[model samples]
Target: SAVISQKPSRDICQRGTSLTIQCQVDSQVTMMFWYRQQPGQSLTLIATANQGSEATYESGFVIDKFPISRPNLTFSTLTVSNMSPEDSSIYLCSVLFSGGGFFGPGTRLTVL
Candidate 1:
């Protein structure tokens, strides 16, 4: 089982600014993902982080808006670039291992 944690649990940023959320896993995992949960909405798959390669972004997401980096199996980072109020949401890091899917505490961003 892999234990996951995220940095900057919550943040308030001005519109047009960006914030990077860090996700760390205790063990190496092959499948890792980034999700966004908007207010009163279900989770949306942002992208899948591929180690040593470019991340696979979902239909509505793009590399320029939400860049992801999976430097290694244990760590990844997602940056919300050129953020706006619409970008304000709960960003969660998830990993699938032998045990099951584990999610990080999540980084809540509020764009003002």
Candidate 2:
């Protein structure tokens, strides 16, 4: 099992600003995934970060808007670019563990 930590439990920011969230893992992992969950909405995969290679982003997400960095096997970062009120959601870092999944506490973002 791997333990994950995310920065900024919650934050409120103005529109047109950006926030970079950091994710740390206790142990090395093969694949790290990012997700977004809006209020009353299901969780959606944002991207998959593989060590030693570029991150694979899901549809509707672009490198310019959601840049990802995975420098090693146990850490990653995601930057939310050009924030807007509609971007308000719970951003999470997830990892597969023991054939299941685990998530961070989540960074609740509210762009005003």
Candidate 3:
């Protein structure tokens, strides 16, 4: 399996601001996705980063609020836009590599 890493391991942002998280995979992978786990809640899929195409967002998530960019096979970014206190959560990137699934160290965001 490939090792995944995320930048800005954690952050504290003010409401109405935005933050972008970078996800890097040690090796090329075909599938990449973003997820968020709110306090005391399970992980929720935000979107699927598709190479050469727009990301596919899951229900309750809109591209305008959670934009994603996949420039290549091994790198992608997810931006939380116009954040609010309710948006504060732990964000994660996941990839399927070598028949195994791996998750990047999450980025914890706190919106004031």
Query: What TM-score do all the candidates reach, one by one?
Result: 0.96, 0.96, 0.96
Model 1 quality (TM-score): 0.96
How would you encode candidate 2's per-residue C-alpha lDDT over 54-103 as one tens digit per residue? 89989998889999999989899999999999999999999998778999
Residue-by-residue lDDT tens digits, candidate 3, 1-112: 8789999899999998999999999988767999999999999999999888999999999999999999999999999999999999999999976687689999999999
lDDT of each: 0.93, 0.93, 0.93
Q: How high is the lDDT of residue 98 in model 1?
A: 64
Model 2 lDDT, residue 88, Cα: 97
Cα RMSD of predicted structure 3 = 1.0
As a whole number from 0 to 100, the lDDT of residue 92 in candidate 3 is 97
Which pairs of residues have clashing backbones in candidate 3? none
* Candidate 1 Cα RMSD (Å): 0.8
Consecutive 10-residue window with the lowest summed lDDT within model 2: 1-10
- Name the weakest run of 10 consecutive residues (lDDT summed) in model 3: 95-104
In Å, residue 73's CA in model 3 sits off its true spot by: 0.6
